[model samples]
Target: MGRDTSSAMVEHLDFFQSFDDVKVYYDNGQNIVKQALDRSVGKVLSKVVVRRRKTSMAGYRLEQVADYLSTIELALVKYEAKEDGETYNKFFGGIGSFKRNWLKQARCKRI
Candidate 1:
């Protein structure tokens, strides 16, 4: 809240009264976060459904084996691409841009 959510807060009663814009923004941010969480949950559920289809019976076991192999292959490709400068830069850049902008200033520096 603009009401100085800070330590010396009560003094900012005027700031609380002026919170109309910030209240709207807080609601909007909560909505966005809820939507993202919903989407992620849907994705995780879908993956579980797909993986469950490869159970241990009949040809299912074979399918599971193939799926595991493909997953490992894809992981290898991603790992190798990370070692290739241009590919790694592009991939990481895309991800960095997609994450919250607030995170930019929060990045940890390594010595």
Candidate 2:
């Protein structure tokens, strides 16, 4: 049996509570968080494929794929912004206490 990678991933990110910490950890060259997420999504996709082969779950797979795509896109945005010299909050507007209280831009910027 394959390992339930969703739990593995959730366990991996046990420290970070916001995108700021996530970006910090990621910028510090520790990518296991996002890597875990990717691995989990891959596992879920494989499970979806197996399920689809056995029966019809097209709608569930479609939703799962959409969610995974959005998650990947968000991670890319944060990674690119961090690489481009922007703080996590400045780039993605994390819901940390400091950022939420202070950095709420009147107009949201496009990623």
- Best candidate, lDDT: 2
Model 2: residues >4 Å from true position, as ranges?
Answer: 1-29, 47-101, 104-111
State the lDDT at 62 in candidate 1: 49
Error of 2 at 11 (Å): 15
Worst 10 residues of 1 by lDDT: 20-29
Please report how far candidate 1 places residue 102 from its true position, in Å. 36
lDDT of each: 0.39, 0.43
lDDT of 1: 0.39
How many clashes show up in model 1?
0
Model 2: per-residue Cα lDDT over 1-111, one tens digit each: 124556654566544333332211112134666565445545643433322123344536755555545654554555556542346456554445323442333213224
Q: Determine which window of 10 residues in candidate 2 has minimal summed lDDT.
A: 19-28
**Model 1, which residues run further than 4 Å from truth?**
1-59, 83-111
**What does each candidate score in C-alpha RMSD?**
20.5, 13.5
Compute each candidate's TM-score over C-alphas: 0.24, 0.23
Please report how far candidate 2 places residue 57 from its true position, in Å.
33
